[model samples]
Target: MTTNRTVQTAADAALWLAVHRGWHVLPLNYGTKTPLRGCADCRAENTDHTPQTCPCLARGDGALCHGVWAATTDASVISRWAQRWHTSVWAVHLGASGLLAVDLDTRPGPPPRHPLNGLPWPADEPPPVDGLDTYATLAALSGGTVGDTFTTDTPSGGLHLVHEAEPGRWKGSHGKVRDGDDTVRTGLGWQIDIKAYGGYVVLPGSTSKAGLYRRSSTTTTPLWRPDWLADALARTGHDRTATPAKATSAPAPVATGGRSGPRRYAVGALRSACTELAVMEPNSGRNRKLFRSTTRLAGMVAAGWIDRTEVETALAAAAGHAGLPAGEIRYALTSGFNRPLPVPDIRSAA
Candidate 1:
């Protein structure tokens, strides 16, 4: 993988890949916007959630890079985006940055906020020049009254919107802290920047959006990959596949949702899975707490784990996996405690 290039970020490249692959995902708000917490001073006008995580902290910039990651089944989409940007797997980073900048500029609210009160293209008027490059478009926006202008974001989180003309020469990371206790392990990140936008038969002649670019991380080395990122990427479809370049004697873990470990085999796995019934439970926290007591699961009542009414409350208070049904239990273990997971019989247990 080649490295060393201009304005690159992990998130930018990932999202860009999705866009190129004909996939578009939700974007997260970073550095504090509205509705969303950490993004306090988002566009500050029409604060919205875009799907980005701050990567600045990883850059040792003492901050996070606020951007989003999109989803897709096409593994090659990311690669293709990176290639278009003349970099590695980093188009997502570029795409996100470009979008965030646009988002910040266009946050919904009445004017006169003094910061980012103007629009890149007037609501009534249209883009002065069609197909402007990312830089040119930013320059126009930052040019005052002609384009978009982001003025004031609370400095507390480091969410100062940079102009396309004045690219901050940014040397730091995001302004937000991570959401989990477990450290995120990263092997390599594809850094990207919004270089330009192009090719649009449908993009209105009045609509002017530029493309983005990204490069592999060469400025600084990425940390923590062997344990967490390796699994997260494959499991989440971030890397698509980690096929080995050379055959090794050691076996690789199968990408199955869950596995059967030695010395631990439960009966009724198929029956539990086939008939397992789960419900959606929403939550927000540093760590995800399973809410079994609060909601009654299909097998919870039959298994005698708890009363139907007590399901929601029990699940909310649930800590670790002990004994739920095989399917429910495994599903929970695999995907955010989807529902109660336990084997049918415990020989003589509650």
Candidate 2:
């Protein structure tokens, strides 16, 4: 396994790992939500582009804002979503233009011809099923990295190893650019209601070649949009540790914790998964979306959009460490779904 120090080049390895594990790498715009959902006036304005001002609110009288940054990385969000939904992140396709985390472990076959797609592997070299193993896989893949790995615990009784990255100036989502349109959730709006930004853009074969900020991006800080080489370099934040291996575990079960229906598992399952995937507690807008997505996925999984096998794996992977069981999970999902069920005394299973 690669350490955080090499995250700068582990993109390829990350992609390979993701593909093998079953995550669909997609590249949708992260903050493309526009107020266009309903209120035309709510649509984000291009007046200044960046979040410095709220274009979403034509006659705004407050600080400029767009969608809130996602509390978790693309990997964690999808990972949790799959577990709750009884599906696998691998089942979906991830797309992005700059998730560079490839490494020697992740090999490329050929040069990329499309600006949006990733480079191809050598003709003789087929894409690895988690196959590509090289020294530079970190940046080669789209996995983010910092300097090194560290163990951290959350309020929820979950242990995890995560990747950290050099604090390269993270330009807030379309904060400076007045693209007029932003975020996929609201569409053509500013303030993408930062609170609603649920997911991150993950393109499997994309490129970071394009500068970080564009008319489409939410980056606004001088650090993110440095005016000069020094400014850019100076603004770059360092996340020395990237790709820390999470100790993926589950929360301990409580008495009388099981659900009472066929689907009561949704609440516990969602809770367990959330405990494992979350780096920070679900507090701010970004975390709120994570929590919501976790619930949505659990309900979706029970509804059958997810395969049983995938659902089990995701839940186990995230919560396995804590040794949480199906009964507890059942309770969590049941509560999360809060739907009617015929199965009574299910919670008694204990």
Candidate 3:
């Protein structure tokens, strides 16, 4: 009698590989794409009006509060988690890992006509999944080189285009774009989503009930995001011009000529902070909002896009204007900067 067999890589093995590659990893539940839930304390705190400001997150304690916030490149920690849950799938936090991904859900068929211009693909060749050809056309129109960008194929036969997550860019969800009027519109047509900051994507070599993820026709590493793609995506989400101007007093002046480039970075921090604050309810818990907003700002600092002190000054003024108390704002900003994140290679385009 013959036995049926196939090679299968272990989940932890995937984690080990990703962590070694400098990607900060997070754990997904066994056989599912969802992130493992936060600890009991974090769960309880979610009931609060300001769930975003969970104290456990700011403390840097042992509790795994926000799953994305818990992403790490630490080999020991990755190995420990892998050992604990052999079935856990591997995921890389987008912004923390300095990577971004475009999710394209497609189906086998004649590819749809370009949505914007209604041009058809060449009739002689077998068409790619629906919507993908459209995206390729759009990317080309936007002056991007989509042909060589690293990509992955999902279990159900969709595609993921991986690129560097540029600082000062916003994330999108399931093709939804939030307008300045607080309305939502369909962006990237109907089948694409841009996952950037505050997002995560499953790594290749991970398995689930759906199936395994595999690299799609890519031999090169993921590249720096093409500016055209970023610009096209920015229109779909919170672009710099889309954010409301801060009504708060100006931030304290920062010294010039440091490694962090305090003054220059502060402008980006303020712009990012204003985007966060503009969406919140005016009376929401200041600490929670501060923590959430500062996380992004601190990432800018950590990425060498800005200075830590610059972020601090900008956030303080933003928080104060939003009615958050002085002490709590300080605590939240400090805790946010102190929180763990993947230290990125600012110089590397990959």
Index of the highest-TM-score prediction: 3
Q: Which candidate is the best by lDDT?
A: 3
Name the Cα RMSD for model 1: 22.5
lDDT of 1 by residue, 97-168 (tens): 332121111222222211110111223333222112212333343332212232122212111222232122
* Worst window of 10 by summed lDDT in candidate 1: 199-208
Candidate 2 wrongly placed segments (more than 4 Å):
1-39, 42-45, 55-162, 166-350
Q: Model 3: residues >4 Å from true position, as ranges?
A: 1-18, 44-62, 107-129, 176-185, 217-220, 240-350
- Predicted candidate 3 versus true structure: per-residue lDDT over 217-248, tens digit per residue: 54536788878766555443334334534346
Residues 1-350 of candidate 2: C-alpha lDDT, one tens digit per residue = 22322222223323444545433232222233111122233334645454334344333322113332111125654344323322111111111111212111112233222111112223344333221121123123323222232222211222111222123322212111123422112111111100111223322222232212111213211121112211211111111222234345443432222333434455455555545444342112222233243455555555643434444445444432433233333433333344322322334644
lDDT score of residue 232 within candidate 2: 17
Range of the 10 consecutive residues with the lowest summed lDDT in candidate 3: 1-10
TM-score of 2: 0.19
Name the lDDT value of residue 127 in candidate 3: 41
Task: Using TM-score as the measure, name the better of candidate 2 and candidate 3.
Answer: 3
Supply candidate 1's per-residue lDDT for 350.
21
